[model samples]
Target: MDVRTAQKLVMENKHAKGFNVTDVPLEVCLLQGEIAEFFTAWRTSEGDAAEELADVALYVLGLAGILNIDLAEQMEQKISKNAARVYERGANGVMYKTTPEQTSAEH
Candidate 1:
């Protein structure tokens, strides 16, 4: 299913299950927790790491629905923005992101 469909289903499931459906802060915290779980599962080489990632995605959809956000659009915009980003290698050989405005300011 598409993100919008999944988002709608997530909210529907949340409401149907009597879960907190309107609490943005709580939703953000829950999403953060799910992310941590995903990271831990991956780090530990757990067989259910994909499941934990699914949990993260579910929470993302639910939270976006609650916030009335067009997640797909936002993702597309962000991806485009990232694609246009410029990076410079630092003294330590690590790359750091720098915007065009910042580069001009430094010059």
Candidate 2:
């Protein structure tokens, strides 16, 4: 199923369970928890990685649905933007954005 269909299913399940996640901060925390679970599953190589990843996606989609955001469109736009990005690692070991000119000069 598509993302919209999956999102709809998640909404239906949430409604059936009376799970009202109105608090944005709580929702964000839950999403972060799911992300941790996904990484744990990846590191252990024991649990179902696909299920954990799906859980992360569910939380993300649910949050977007609650906010009335077009997640798919946003994802596409972000992908397009990232595709043209040039990044550099700082002394602090964080990746920072670099201009196209800087990227060309590095080559």
In model 2, the runs with Cα more than 4 Å from the true position are 87-96, 100-107
The CA lDDT of each predicted structure is 0.89, 0.85
Q: What is candidate 1's lDDT per residue for 1-107, written digit by digit as tens?
A: 88778888899999999998889999999999999999999999975899999999999899888889989889897888789899999999999988763355664
* TM of each candidate vs. truth: 0.83, 0.74
Each candidate's number of clashing pairs is 0, 0
Q: Runs in model 1 with CA error above 4 Å?
A: 101-107
Error of 1 at 96 (Å): 1.8
Worst lDDT 10-window in candidate 1 = 98-107
| Clashing residue pairs found in predicted model 2 | none
Q: Judged by TM-score, which candidate is best? A: 1
Please give the distance, in angstroms, between residue 50's alpha carbon in candidate 1 and its true position after superposition: 0.6
lDDT by residue (tens digit), candidate 2, 1-107: 88778777887887789876577788899999999999999999979889999999999988987887878788887888788888999999999989653355675
